[model samples]
Target: MGWARQKQQHHNAAFFWRYLLMASALCLVFFTPLCRAGAENHRNAYATMMYMGTPRDYEFYVAIRVLLKSLAALHVDADLVVIASVDVPARWVRALEKEDGAKVVRVENMDNPYKKQANFDKRFKLTLNKLYAWSLVDYDRVVMLDADNLFLRKTDELFQCGQFCAVFINPCIFHTGLFVLQPSMTVFKDMVHELEIGRENADGADQGFISSYFPELLGQPLFHPPANGTRLEGTYRLPLGYQMDASYYYLKLRWSIPCGPNSVITFPGAPWLKPWYWWSWPVLPLGIQWHEVRRQTLGYSSEMAVVLIQCAIYIGIIGMTRLARPSLSKLCYRRSDKSTYLVQNCLKLVAFWCILAAYIAPFFTIPHTVHPLLGWSLYLLGSFALCSIAVNAFLLPILPVLVPWFGIIGVLLVMAFPWYRDGVVRALCVFAYSFCCAPFLSAAVSKIMVALQLTFEREAFLPRLGESNPPSGFNKLY
Candidate 1:
């Protein structure tokens, strides 16, 4: 009985082993294609890191590290190319080495001696002449990124849009903040040769040179996305979040409320580094204030106030032009003839009305309003005053020839209190206060007062003029 039981156990054990082998084979057959597919996908994914130099400052290094970390989080395998005069720090190299899939290549001896004086070199680390030369290094596609830039999202999709010699779209070409460039050693060499020979010195920067020459090289293959796509036609530009318009906020006192988080921000002239007085505080604070108020009031009163103020200013300036028309015409032209004065006044009125019509048409036609009412009103008023001054200057030759010195004064005042300048707010406030204190504040009030004064002047002066006008001959004198 013991021998029979042992033999039966051995037979069962062999059957169980055979069943396990068959199941293992079946599992491999089912999963092999999936494994292969995954491997193939891994092979297809390509990524790269490109930096011009080892950033000299801590902030820039931190930004680069942040960019790299973001790239890694997206499962992209990247190779870092550093174009620098000095070697990368040992610690940075070690840290990057420990990173699973990062490689760093140092390209030496490319520093520009004129970097400090040359804006192009200071910004791009290369002159227009040398850009093509440096671009000759080997890679499938290279992304040139400024050291200070931070990448918040995966850019792998940028690669999916087929390769071009170079691809970028901004208000201007050669943003260089972030751009994808295809590999071309020959083009790079040619660009370098051109740079060395000063072939691109006239336009001022490598960007200008590239813009001028890229069309010829690429034969319409180079892509330049427009600022507004519907107004143009091409690939939808990189989401606004991808490139923030930093200039409006940082450098200029212009504010824009982005529609969404993904809106690309582009800083012009490094606004974070240099903030503008008018735009820096007012826009951010006002935006926050409006956001809070919007929730409670369900209305944009502040914005409306700003727009109304702007409109009021515009209307006031137009009124001022009408009030000052006679004096301006007399001062602009020396001709005493009523016919000449009438023609000059008509021309001035037509010009002013045309400007007004053009300015107001946009507000009614498109709902795309940026400034609040008060702000817009102020802008229009200031614009009208300035335009009136300009038109008067142009007409001064034909009419009442005042001392040219007044035109210079006008120019200085316009410059000192320019609509776009930081000082404009104070100027506008002063003007508004003056207008409020005027004896005849409204147009009707002013016109009535002027008419009464004119009636009194005519009664007092007409009898003397009639009695005195008696000289004979063609020239009758009063």
Candidate 2:
């Protein structure tokens, strides 16, 4: 009986052990989370950009997409991400995911946290949300880059560096672009706290917060991990290649040491020098590479597209105006004598059409061999076009398209040609020959000009034959 009892107990114990082992194996095979394994596999740090909103925000997103495509083309293994707010259109988000195989992380829009003000208009705004980048704990390390940054060569080795690293943007100032950082919410919170209570920097936006937080560390030696598996904490200055400013690069060649093969080229500061700026091609050759990326990948010049749409809308309004008025199109720009023939009238109409075409030409294609003055005109014209399209104050749809050209060309004509320079006199001469249908349009515009002349200088418009410049009748009219 004792031998049988001992054998039964041993058999039960073996069965229990077998059952436990089977369950453990099944759990190990089935229940382990793939997320952890996937994350562990992709342990390398990532780079990201931010764009909250702009009138031309679409172009900005397209630029980001182009950067990602460039990375893929080079067969770079690093992931590129963009954290945008709800203000960014949904189409931009989809493009980032579908076309570029990039990630789009949406965060709430935050205002500029830094209290400091920039001395000049810095072309970019609402960049304080960059702080949220540090909150992405998924990435063991992160390299934050400005959306305007274009990568030239592979910078994957940057991940081997320490937690905090950046390049000098301004003299003695570290640029936030292309900075390596370890993801931690604590750092994010501390930045927020500093922004709220601490003094803001002179440059404003993200530069202030980053510069303040990492002060006196520009020249500091960074953490160099020893072969024995231990690490130290320090901030490292990035090589010039990482944050190469385009303006400063040329300036260095002129006055200072010219830098070598830059890893990234940062087009910052001037709004016009940006890759997708309206006059990017002719105004600044530096933006051409970025412009090419935009054209080849996106299928069109993104900046010119916005201008084209605005022009089309203006044309539609002009067409509708012509349809409604009927007589306006047939009328001549000059009120010429038509008793013998309408030849001069026809010539006047032809000149008006030519002027209209001239206005639209620059938006379509900038001439490669333009004079310096024409380049300046393109630059000015580009600014006026962008602002006019985005402006709410200009209710007259046609005015945006017409006014800038007329203003620039008219001012030029006034300077060189005697007729346009003395606008009021020319306007009066047209009014004097008030026999044609075009005279009414001229008369209305002339009156507005005269009113402006009187309002500001009160002597810009010369008085009529009977009245003084500041007429004695002015008091009675009031």
Candidate 3:
């Protein structure tokens, strides 16, 4: 009888376990879809950047596209957006949508009501369009960005920040290059209203306006995301890592931000120094990382054809000048003594102008957005070609004529040295180098003048280029 009772107890326990397993499986099957649907309904965050139609439109377009692609490569769990003015080209807009996987939001150009303010910069006129970030109420949060930002890693966790947050890269003010904010129509409308009223803006730009709008951001406690995945409320100061200025890294040549993820690097110094400009590299070593992402993504197609054409033209110029040098050397200018002085002065003027053109022409010939090595090479090649024209035309010595080119190279090498202890030291060294080079440059000019005077005295019967001048008289030459 006792054995029979034991068997019954074991059978009852097995029956209980079987029902529990069946119930658990049923709950999972029924509840999983509901949980997923709720998640789908929740508003997503976006990684947003902006573009304005300005003289540098194409440059900014390339910059924003590169930033979007870099963010996409990180697989950040947020939508990528670009707030472009309506004047942006349709082809550019399409490229952003189809090629880069970014949603382009078209906004009207915002008028800077503070334009009449003293010290106002015209470049900041349309920057007021940045206020449109608050108007994107469909997204729960948005990380507003400038195209110059370089992201080192994913920063999706920034979405968990408060209603407004920015990094105080400066001691007394926060940098707006990369900032997190909750999107709200009410806030956006109020901002527009404030602009209409001509609010007091120190810098007459979005940076000043936004800073004024959130005055207490400086005093707020530093933000740390909650472990429970809860988003914070009110304004907060972000850690130095999120918007690390590229200048900061130059001091140590390494990132040492102790708080937050050292993710984004901002180029806030000068427009020309933005990482997208090929020449910005080596000067800012981090620019290489930006270009690597660009090469992987965009691959320089927009400017390549133009770059190739310029290269071919420069090569032809160089070759033609070299081939004709002997013929060119025999050609000379001569005139009667009465007008020889006037002729000599006019010829000297023309020669100086040609030399100046040689130094200036290459800057405008090369495509503005090529790779650094390519851009610098094209520039030097073009300069050499242009200088050759002046050299053969005026019969000047080669080394003195190439002084400006050598000076440019010297400056680049000094700026790109990479071992400065701090930016102040780097700046001082550059200043000292420039001061030292001034005398050499002045001497080069003097040598050029002396060479020009010698050419003026050379006697010739047949004038191929221009009318010849006597030893102390006037004669014009072409």
* Candidate number of the best lDDT: 3
State the local distance difference test value for candidate 1.
Answer: 0.42
TM-score top scorer: 3
* Model 1: per-residue Cα lDDT at residue 409: 35
Per-residue lDDT of candidate 1, residues 1-478 (tens digit): 9999999999999999999999999989999989875643331222223333423343333334444554555555345443322355656655554642344554554444334444544545443323532353555555555543434355554443333333233534535455455546776777666556655442355556656555443333333333343222222233344555454443344544342233233334533331111222233322222222223322333235556565666577667755665332222212234543355446555544543454444344221222233333344345445455433423322111222223323433443342454434544544664555343224433443344334323423122222343223313322
Give the TM-score comparing model 3 with the true structure, all chains together.
Answer: 0.82
lDDT of 3 by residue, 1-478 (tens): 9999999999999999999999999999999899976644345555555555467877888888888888888877777888888888899889989998887889888888888888998888888888999988888889999888888888887788899999999999998888999999899999999999887789999999999999999999998888888888888999998889888787777788897888888889888788878778777777777888888877898888988898899899889888886323343445445455566677778888988898788877777778887888888888888899888877889888888889888888888787777666877888998999898889988998888777654534233234343433224454
TM-score of model 2 relative to the true fold?
A: 0.56
| TM-score-superior candidate, 1 or 3 | 3
Residue 197 local lDDT, model 1: 62
Cα TM-score per model: 0.40, 0.56, 0.82
Ranking by TM-score: 3, 2, 1
State the displacement of the C-alpha of residue 95, model 3, in Å, after optimal TM-score superposition: 0.4
Residue 461, candidate 3: Cα error in Å is 7.9
